[model samples]
Target: MSTRHVLLGLLASGPSHGYDLKRRHDEQFPEARPLAYGQVYTTLQRLVRDGLAEVDGTGSDGGPERTAYRATEEGTRELSRWAGEITPPAPFVTNEIFAKVVVSILSGGDPAAYLRAQRAAHMGRMRELTAVKSAAGAGLATVLSADYALNHLDADLRWMTTTEDRLTTLTAEVDAA
Candidate 1:
């Protein structure tokens, strides 16, 4: 997604300076990965030039003079349009959990241990992603692209659960050995 759209979405919430947009952007996505500060500021600048943002100089300190940005009507419409078009990110670009699990397996610790640790991580992530998903549920309605993302998570969760269950069964069988 264009950073301008991201900035617009953040600006739609309220007037904010560049740093504020950075914080909101971080909160919108997981911190395990982040949008760079450069991207944030650059996008904010573009939005200002695009007429989507206005400088609210009413509140600022003397040093560097924090320029508060408010969304213009055009900006609001653009933001709303962008919001309606919100879709899940591409799988290769977004789903690192699966990749992490593959790396864990290749790194060659005990498979059971790896699976257990992986399960723990995904479970924790699932909780976090879930909260974001719920809060953004409305945006997700038209976001058919999210299905691939959800599918990847769902598969990982199931793989972990099934592996855990199978490991338990195998442990019982091994004890009989």
Candidate 2:
């Protein structure tokens, strides 16, 4: 989900300073999706420019005064429309392992070496994902987020393993021929 939508959703609940928004984003967004201060500020600026949030108050944040933001009527309307229209979907990350392996094969590099690296990577991912799910089941994951992460991880692991198996089978058959 866009930071715009998340900030607006937070504002819908209550007015908050930018730092608070940042904290909540850390909680909600995955670690891979780590947002920097610049991105948050930039997105907030866009929201302000689009007539979504307005400065309501200013306060100290451990040192300096930070402007608090609240949703404007137009902002609320936009946020609401966005919320209804935008059901957050899982992020789509391109699989470089297969692509790179293909490139290596075409370039006459050792397929086994590349595939070995890919195997390690995918296996490591599976183990990590399994650990995450276990931690979630044990109620140890951050923000009780194991379930959402687990579901996706399972999907990914399944796909990775299946793809690897199919590729290996194809390679073996072709080599035999």
TM-scores for all candidates: the values are: 0.46, 0.53
What is the C-alpha lDDT profile of model 1 across 56-123, one tens digit per residue?
Answer: 76554666657688889999999888778847665454456545544544554355776777778866
Cα-lDDT of candidate 1: 0.71
lDDT of all predictions:
0.71, 0.73
What is the Cα-based lDDT of residue 31 in candidate 1?
37
Candidate 1 lDDT score at position 147: 52
* Cα shift from native, residue 171, model 2 (Å): 8.5
CA deviation > 4 Å runs, candidate 1:
58-64, 86-177
Task: Tell me the lDDT of model 1 at 45.
Answer: 76
Tens digit of lDDT per residue, candidate 2, span 44-104? 8888898888888887858888988899999889877877785546476566765775655
TM-score of 2: 0.53
